[model samples]
Target: MAIQSSKTVSACLQWVIIPTGSHICMAEFFKTSVTWVVDFHYEGRPRRWFKAFGPHDDPFQQMTDTLKDLYGDRAKLASVRKATDEEELQYLRGEEPKNSYCPTGR
Candidate 1:
């Protein structure tokens, strides 16, 4: 279930409290699930990462599809491409822009 209006994820964080937490919830917070494009792949198996979400908020069905569709649409893609860095920060709280770039600062 989504936290909805509440910004705090403490309750959800408690779900990971090993006495601690569910394996799935742990996976989501860590961003190590296969759903994250650059996320770690466990052993040789790619996890069904979106399975951590409840059916109601289906991240895969909702966010991923929208992301893919926008990626395929030139107009939509152009709009986001013009976003300023500050605006981009707010836009990607969870949303993915197809040409995601991660700076390594290396």
Candidate 2:
């Protein structure tokens, strides 16, 4: 579930509860599950990464999450697009593309 706030809430107040002053709402955002091929840079070298997202997942948000998990502020996402069937198959089969670099920095 994603927590979103109304316009009435100020930017600084968004992080904390105003008790009786602000109105906050919790909403569920949903998107179709998708397999994405993400192009990014790691250690100044271009690389590729793939992942399947859940129905509620956002691709851009996932990219940020990946950046935090893998590079801790160094990783940068370049491109994101739906994965082709062959690419998805390779990802599922635990195989990496011959022409692209894919490494788990962790």
Task: Estimate TM-scores for all models.
Answer: 0.19, 0.54
User: Model 2, which residues run further than 4 Å from truth?
Assistant: 1-32, 98-106
Model 1 steric clash pairs: 16-20, 17-20, 18-21
Clashes of each: 3, 0
lDDT against the true structure, each candidate: 0.35, 0.68
Q: Candidate 1: where is the Cα deviation over 4 Å?
A: 1-55, 73-100, 104-106
- Cα-based RMSD of candidate 2: 12.7
lDDT against true structure, model 1: 0.35
Best by TM-score: 2
TM-score of 2: 0.54
